[model samples]
Target: MLIGEVSQRCGVSTRMLRHYDALGLVKPTGRTSNGYREYSADDIRRLFHVECLRTLGLSLNEAKRALDEPDFAPSELVGELIGHTRARIAAEAELLRKLERVDAAAPAQWADVMGIVTLLRALESESGARRQQAVLSQNEGASLPVEALAAAALSEHDPNVAGALRWSLARAAGEGLTDLAIGLDSAVVEVRRRATVAIAAVPTAEATVLLRRALDDGDVMVRSRAALALGSRHVADAIPVLLGMVVEGRSDVEAAEVLGVLAEVAAAADVIVLAMQDKLDNTDDAPTRLRITQALAEIPGVAARGVLAELADDGDRTIAATASAIAHTLDRRKRQGFRN
Candidate 1:
């Protein structure tokens, strides 16, 4: 086949075939009387091999070596190609994500598009300060897309940056709740915890519902954060987890405080006091019992008074002293109220 015929049949352009010949990569096996290049069947086979290697991301030189070198080992080269291909694919995928985020912002002009792009890049910057600044200064630019904020909040490891991201997401009025809700089911424990952290700041009823669902997460941190958030929102669903936190000494003080707030309700007070009493009954460690005794001080109802009175003369002197002190204070308050 002549050069043109070879180019047409092999899909390699004539210019490229000439370049290959100049590089000594593939030379036509013969020449016609007019001295035009002519390719034999063997030459066409070599050209096909070069094209095949190119598809695998081999440079021309590497492809030539692969075809001509009897000792050329493809194993290492193939592995390198695979790694390069994966890196290229990852880069392309990231670009696509960036484009999607920009498109989602629905920029009205080039300036708005530029601002959003700049903000997006800053959020992904290596510096935690930059990431935080981007979120905190979001109002200076076109409003950030809520989905971007949600993604940043979920993936951020820096406490300050993550907090800022969550705050920003909250200000978006729960627009990113869908993304955050999906994060709740992530296989990654940190992701779920971060989602809960972000959702906790959102005051919308939808956010409250998501937090309630997060309370049942298998990860203790997720459940703890969700429970605490729920407790602050006056959701009774947090009671069981709050009680567990008190029992396990995990953020027990904050848990106790929230429980106290929950205890303001008459019915909730009874249940809270009864649960603490049950814990006291089953627990033998003096420190655990002491912690529970102190927690009971936060509750003001009559049921809590009964538990405090019984604990006042317990075997542990420290527990007895603390309980007696609390009971005495409650009595003084009760009497003071009566006097008025």
Candidate 2:
């Protein structure tokens, strides 16, 4: 077979085949009378081998060594190729994600595209302050894409930066809701918690619905944040988790406050009082009983006062004293027409 025949049949271009011959990687072993390069059957086989190695990401020099060096172990070279291929793939994937985020921004000009890119780079900065500034600096002039903000919010480990990202999402008018919803489904517990935290700041009904889904998250913080957010929206579904947070003493103060707001309704106040009473009955821990005692004070109405009145005379001295103090305050408020 001549060089052209080999190039045509084996799919290696003529110029590339000549380069391979110059490099001594797959030299054709025959020549016609006109002195044109000719390829023997064996040379074609060697050319095929080089092409095969190239497909696996081997450089020309590496392919030459692979075919010519009897002592060249392929295991190490193959492993290196695998690593290089993976790195290339990862780089491409990251680039694709960046492009997608930029496209989502729908930049009106090259300047807007540059601005978005700059903000994205800042968000990924090693310095927490820089990352936070990236989020804080987002304004009407060069508003960031909501998807970018949502991604940053989900992955940020620093509380301050994360808070800024959440605030940015809140101002995005629910644009980040869909990304945050997908984040809620992430297998990473912190991602779910961050998603819930960010979603809580978004005041849309869609945000409220996503928070309800997070209420069942396995992470205690995720569920607690969701419950607290829902409680602020007066979603009744948060009642159980709110009570649980009080019992566990996790963000118990905020939980109690939200519960108090929920208890403004007479029917809800009645149920909350009973639930606190149940916890007080079941727990022998003085701290837990005290937390329940304090939580009950947040709720107004006769039902809470009735529970407090009963707790005021309980056996635990601290709990009884605290309950007495809170009950007295409730009475004073009622007398002042602050409660019924």
Best by lDDT: 1
Which parts of model 2 have CA positions greater than 4 angstroms off? 1-21, 25-49, 141-143, 280-286, 309-320, 331-340
RMSD in Å for model 2: 3.7
Each candidate structure's TM-score, on Cα atoms with residue i matched to residue i, is 0.81, 0.81
Worst 10 residues of 2 by lDDT: 137-146
For candidate 2, give the lDDT of residue 2. 83
Least accurate 10 contiguous residues by lDDT in model 1: 138-147
> Model 1: per-residue lDDT, tens digit, 1-340?
8999999999999999999999999999899999999999999999999999998899999999988899999999999999999999999999899889888878888887787888888987999998888778866435567778888888989999998988888787888899999899999999999999999999999999999899888999999999998988888889999999988899999999999998988888888888888899998988889989999988877788888889988989999999999998888988999999
